[model samples]
Target: MIRSYRLLSLLVLALFALEPLQAQLMNKGTIKFEVTDVQTNNPDMQQMIGSMKGMAQTLQFDGAQQQMTVDMMGGLMRINTFWTGANSTVETYMDMMGQKIKTIMSNEDVEKMRKESEAMIKSEDIKYDKSVTKKILGKDCYKAYYETDANGQKFSMEMYVTEDIKVPNSFLQNLNQIELKGTPLMWIMDAGMMKMTFMATDISKDLGSDFFKKPEGAYQEMSMEQLKQMGMGGQIGF
Candidate 1:
């Protein structure tokens, strides 16, 4: 009886040890990332990059609702989009110059953006180096290498991603155009004079429904065309 009791206790401890691992592999949660660095070739852009340093962004996934939200710029800008079913509204909220602005993109607008992005991805040389793996934010991630040539400017990129925590692949299209088996945990992009890196700082299951809802208050609404003319359409992930 003593030996049986000891074996039972060990079994319980082993199961408890696997609990966190199971949670980490679960497909539902919110992941927080920080912009550790940003580099650019344009001197003017470099000056603006300082405001983005140490900036934090949160990507929340609601498996039940099949929706996701990317909150960046210290919550001053948020892009909300859906992954499953038909959601005609892709909403973004931005706080600019003490004014709250809400930008709405229709399903047609999002589809157009997707095609343009797909073309851009096709133009790049992207590959995965699975042999390289690192533990980032306590989760294992693999490396991906790629190069981008935009407007006659070429740059190289290295990204770390993990397949353990699953989320809709479409959710990452705005930041990354390549098709990946995992979610990016860290990235280092080099464009001669410009460089930028994003690192995941936290991953948790504490996401709430409220995180996906629009902010409470008056907001000036703008259509996709107006935002594009203002050179701000991309800010909303369009």
Candidate 2:
């Protein structure tokens, strides 16, 4: 379960790691994606989770406001993260057992995490192959390939990038680490026996302002460490 959680987190990060280039070419729009397929190498996990399809995530970028929101939903897990250039806040809601729990990471917490991650950053080689071209969601894209080792585990990635649209490079370090270029319209990640693909289904310009705001209500807020403990304890329950 812990491994699965980590894989899912990586998947989300890969799907939204866009960096800014020229400001004039920046496109402000919302991209909706669906998890088209999922499979793992572990037979035990295969028996437990079966197929992971129909999971949905949305990425909204407002170039004028310099803000973005990512909302990912799968079964009983819902994660909403808001990014404002340099800082971010994450609100994760989980339905574990019969209890509904929520975890919030304020901007200060996210800044601390950023510092810690920077201190641990290491150099890794990434190779890109742009031999294939395809049209995804009406946009022309070229396929690029790369591989990396994260936390001693190796993973390979196939990404479809386009030169037509440019996005802000808020997470420039992450993009440089992965060695990705252009805009990624679709991404497929393979780690061990686990494989998942996220493809954009639609792009629209009118994402309402309310979509990025934090919800107003009661939720049992917890720290990042507590959330990790719950996640490891199988309290994710998804």
Candidate 3:
């Protein structure tokens, strides 16, 4: 009987040990990422970046749909993006300089925009390497690289992504028209003169349906075409 009790105790402890690991793989949670590093040679830009350091991005996902919020220019510009795989639609709400603008696009619209924005970039431009691997929050991650030319300027980025966080493939339009197999816990962006590293700082499961609600209030509705007409195409994302 004592031996049986010992075995049962060990079993209980083992199950307890696996609980957190199981939670990590569950496709529901909020990942808070912070701008951990900034590389720039401009003194004025450094001061600007210093203030932007307080800026952080939050991504909330629950397998079916996802919402990402990004703050730019020390919160002078805020972009909130919501995508639902069920309806295959994306809604972007931008709050900047006292102007509230909202835009909704269907999957077809997104693909069309993807084509125009990706005239110089294509899916083949992204490369993934399994040999390059690391650990973020105890999950396996691999390296991937993407490069493209923005008009005449060159853009490049590297990501350390993991398959542990399962999100819908339709939600993959954010990474420059390329589909990444997993969520990126760490990524480095190289934009010629400035470089920035975004790292996931915390993950929490304290989310609900209410968290994904559309923005309320007097947000002026705008179509994707009108947004581009204003030359603020880069201010929002799907």
Candidate 1: tens digits of C-alpha lDDT, residues 55-87: 566666654433444444455444444333245
**CA lDDT scores, all candidates in order:** 0.56, 0.55, 0.63
Which parts of model 1 have CA positions greater than 4 angstroms off?
Answer: 1-24, 40-46, 64-88, 123-125, 169-178, 191-193, 233-238
Q: Better model by TM-score, 1 or 2?
A: 1
Pick by lDDT: 2 or 3, better one: 3
Better of 1 and 2 by lDDT: 1
Model 3 lDDT-worst window of ten: 12-21
Model 2 stretches with alpha carbons more than 4 Å out: 1-26, 47-51, 64-75, 86-124, 150-152, 168-179, 231-238
Q: Rank order by TM-score, top first?
A: 3, 1, 2
C-alpha TM-scores of all predictions? 0.74, 0.70, 0.76
User: With candidate 2 superimposed using the best TM-score fit, by how many Å does residue 124's alpha carbon deviate from the native?
Assistant: 7.6
Task: Give the higher-TM-score candidate: 2 or 3.
Answer: 3
For residue 134, model 3's alpha carbon misses the true position, in angstroms, by: 2.3
Clashes of each: 3, 5, 0
- Of the two candidates 1 and 3, the one with more favorable lDDT, higher being better, is 3
